[model samples]
Target chain A: MSNYSLRHLQELEAESIFVIREVFAQFENPAILFSGGKDSIVLTHLAKKAFWPAKIPFPLVHIDTGHNFPETIDFRDKLVENLGARLVVGLVQDSIDQGKVAEETGLNASRNALQTTTLLDTIEANKFDAAMGGARRDEEKARAKERFFSHRDDFGQWDPKNQRPELWNIFNGKKNMGEHFRVFPISNWTEMDVWQYILAENIPLPSLYFAHEREVIERNGTLLAVSDYLNMRGDEVKMTKTVRYRTCGDMPITGAVESNASTLEDIIVEIAATRMTERGTRADDKRSETAMEDRKKQGYF
Target chain B: MTQSGYLDMELLRFTTAGSVDDGKSTLIGRLLYDSKSIFEDQLEAVKGSSQKKGLAHIDLSLLTDGLKDEREQGITIDVAYRYFATPRRKFIIADTPGHIQYTRNMVTGASTANLALILIDARKGVIEQTYRHSYIASLLQIPHIIVCVNKMDLVDYDQERFNEIVKTYEAFASKLDVQDIRFIPISALEGDNVVNRSTKTSWYEGSTLLHTLENIHIGSDYNHLDARFPIQTVIRPHRQEYHDFRGYAGRIDGGVFRPGEEIIVLPSGFKSKIKEIMVGEEKVSEAFPPMSVTMTLDDDIDVSRGDMLAKPNNQPDSTQDLELMMCWLNNRGLNPSSKYILRHTSNEMRTMVKEVIYKLNINSLSKDESDKNIGMNDIFRAKLRTTKAVLKDAYRKNRNTGSLILVDEATNETVAAGMIV
Candidate 1:
């Protein structure tokens, strides 16, 4: 056990820190795409350590769907205040109010897809050359081929086939004036690794992640929290299930799981034995097989 | 978590090179399925797709065929990284494409790999690709190579066919620089000797592919004798408690560093003592390769990003002239007069291609000294003249310090990956 090699979690952490610092050094302006999810929470914590004692240099850009769970908003505000980092909010509600995007009117209607417009507009408005995200490759098939430093056109579109070949530790962040980059520091991390690192580092997370009694509607075999943003339809009876969200996304799109994993240790054990990928719980992905790949091309985080 | 031995699990990154027809993706899918890494929902999606496409059996390759175009064409055009873990180790498989874009994709995948899986059809004893792939693996200095003589089911699990292919590969690979080479007979499509011991190959005594991957000694893959830290950025908090804290933040490229160790900064050639290695505010007594840490120096010298700190006695070479074996990635051919931005570790300097020594005919495993026109997928040896001296080691000696990439000034795309000779 007296070896110098690092465990998988440690190695992943180091690689992520290196990438964060590279974003700071390579781009004129870079902001973290924080979604108040477990993945983004871990990413922000790593940024804090990446430049110890120095507050995170870049601001956190949240593409608020305006349909978020109150817990996620509250958690986001508190974390930002604690880190003394700046928070930039891009409201999809604003996009709707300005007649920029139309809301879908259907049973599976969600503001999840509208976040792309807000996100792209936010990046352009802020003139951010790079947006560091918490996206992991193992989450979906399209992401499995994503580069750590992914390129984006001026329109903030992802060209999977036309990406620059990333080699070794060197990241190429160079682009035209109008073009930008979407950097995924945690591209190599898996769902299990994220939970493991969170436990090992004692990183604080949103309480919504812990099992709690909540009013939810079981639709399509997945639990959706009953929030003001989501109204139950006929025969979509509300069930007071002790559930925790596997992913922190928009209220209508995110799905919850039946669990009693209130403690971090319990959560890790639950995740280890689980037979589902984290993104599998996401309702938006069920719309189509290429749902994620399509949104990613249109600049969805 | 600790009771499950999760804490002790190490990481291993490997590359797989073979076309779809050779069952490369099928092998990866088998590994994931047997390891329980493939989730139920994902399997269901694959099953649904298989049914819609009228596939007789579940097409496992669909799982790795990611992008829309790739899925439509039933081919992989880029290197898709796949993850699977057993209890013993976490595996990151760089499933490199084996199509027309072979060399560039394989080089990118092999750069950080500890082992490479070169597939050979049992029926096709030794093909041109076997030589090309094995050469690239050796050129990149990958530590281990597993020649998976696949489709044993097609060959009736004949040990003689597998043995013949193994001997042919060994004779060709002997001319290369790789150290550890092994052979395995398996049928990735039929789930034989991939994750489980195959009774079909009763004459084979070697371990299964998964077993070898789990048990391979990868601790020595990193260079531990030389401590080289290239400063990525300067972490100057300027806070009240640590007003004068000037920590050099970087990942150790090689070896280890501890407090009270004497070191020297490159280019400036300034001497300093290791004050402490800080992970955050807390101090770590020792730091090693791939671990990013902030270190302070006892002596207050001018140190910034792109600066290297190494033991004075064991320093790397620094010179304006460099020799490198580079793989051209961009579509535009190499122009000798054009200057490219060469990035080595944390250092970036403008450099010009002084001369092209030779272009490698990978399929033939020969050097084409007369082919100076380096095009895409071409690996060529060349001399570079840097604007400033760079601290470097041979790629074979240390991958971290020895490797670099060239960025086109106009396109800004990474055009070439260079391995110092």
Candidate 2:
């Protein structure tokens, strides 16, 4: 027995780095599913560290829902440029234009679910055998049972019941020609862990996470940002409110919370004292009981 | 903001195995509730689901029963990960079900665990479930085993009953391979001996379950004596600054290695000196097991993934024949005639099952040599013949380097988890 020991964050970082290195070693064409969120940014940072001295051996794939917060897009492009990594954008609008996917009709509709079609199509087009996502198990129930190396059918649908058994640190990436695998390196990380790591590593994030003044409308007790992507036909009055986004997603579905935590330190304090789950404000998850599961079954990230 | 103290906290990963009646959910709920891990939205959602199901109170079991089918079927199918952190340490709970593919789920959960929490109903004493749970924990070589005797309230918090259960378990544990074992009487339902010291168990002198988990000495769990580094990938900058940079990247499976140390590359028998070990951009003096780092050698030698580096005097065996204790994980039985791909660490080789030594009946905790027909959730000792020599160690020696998994090529499914003899 030796006195040398690693902290929890270091251990997690090591595990994540190991998984990323495995992806680079095992898969033929792998890509990071970057959503411009804090999780994805942290994933990219870890991936960079995993193959330092050598560039990250995979492209960063962003499934563009065409309704993203402008800051997310700018930040994504800048980060990609700084990392010297290739960025592949899959547009949901392109799928809609090609009649491959139809847009939702009602006002509450979002391009969130439609990202599945574009994402699968992008994976198929790029011939990516493995798509690394930053989704944590603590986020959703169905995700809680996800294997670190998740297998998807040829149609890209995840069969939660029939996942391959992953043992120890050994991951089996073997799959059929058309079948792809979705690997989550940070499957064990919680939201607090992610925030702590981000702060510890001093990783850069989009400005939307910090508190700022924005015109938003109150709907179902949520502050919806007034943007072109969001509909304003309802009678809800729009007012300027200082809010910060917990999760970065499309404008219509991603809600903001009013807070004074503009810095990462203050955000951590707020998160520590906060009672609600980060995804509680997500309108997409509020749709149904098994919303994430339903979409994940249809090959959603 | 309060930050630096939490950074010093180490991680303690433990798996909890119990049946529905063992009150596993109650124990987990109490732990999370005491630590304030469950968020308000999560509880609200659970409450809403409980109301929708017409339940009078919140079903904490719903929180652990993950996936749509599991909720619908009223049983856990796979291992679900749950997290909670106290001021002293952070914990990851691999909450595995006791039945319905118990072997597969428990093995997956126990593979990375430092401890195993085997729950037993105080009223039931030592049942078959207890035997199965303890057996899996022992077989997986979990460093710590805490037999949590739940439902002590139901047994009137009797010390004699607890002592009797512990004696019965001790009789059974003699057959197991585990060493560090402890007992604690807990009433998860009544929060007795769970978080705080219970007044009912004034006769009990042991620490509470939460205290035990928080203060357990897990620093020595890793193998820091045998330096075994299996290369997962090669790092080549091919850039301007570091043009000739060629490094072997891997997580140390065992022991430690430092610069200027003599090492031998497996299969090639090429001797080289460790020039430097770099974790990301910074060079470290030494590296140990579970730390991912890139090491550069003095001599220019061809070393790639699946190759292992170790001290010349103390090296792992590279052999084509492998004898292992395998737990069949898939629905399909272990087919001796079927060609399977054996994955060990970063290495993969075509392998076939030569023979089945024996199958252990998990229920009775006895070996059944006559029953050679192996199926899912069946743990058996078998001989495997690989197409190429694999660098390996005994499972009890180095868990990272000594274990392997067999993948079914046709269906592309992981069929078995094997621990080397």
What are the TM-scores, per candidate, against the unseen true structure? 0.98, 0.98
lDDT of 2 by residue, B168-265 (tens): 99998998898799999998878898898899999999999999999989988999888999999999988999898899999999998999999999
> Which lDDT tens digits does candidate 1 get at residues B259-374?
99999999799999999988766678889988889999998899988989999999999999999999999999998889999999999999999999998888886888987999
Residue range with the least summed lDDT across 10 consecutive positions in model 1 chain B: B1-10
lDDT of 2 by residue, A1-301 (tens): 5456778887888899999999999999999999999999999999998998999899999999999999999999999999899999999999999999899977788899899999999999999999999999989887888888999999999988788877899999888889999999999898989998888878899999999999999888888999888876667798999999999988998899999998899999999899888899899998888989999999998
Q: What local lDDT does model 1 show for residue A114? A: 91
Each candidate: RMSD: 1.6, 1.8
DockQ of each: 0.64, 0.67
Give per-residue CA lDDT, model 1, range A1-301, as digits (tens).
Answer: 2377788888888899999999988888999999999999999999999998888999999999888888999999999999999999999999999999999887788999999999999999999999999999999999999999999999999989789998889998889889999999999999988998889888999998999999999888889988878867898988799999889998887999999999999999998899998888898898898999999999887
Q: Which stretches of candidate 1 lie over 4 Å from their true place?
A: B1-6
Q: Which pairs clash inside model 1?
A: none
Error of 2 at B128 (Å): 0.4
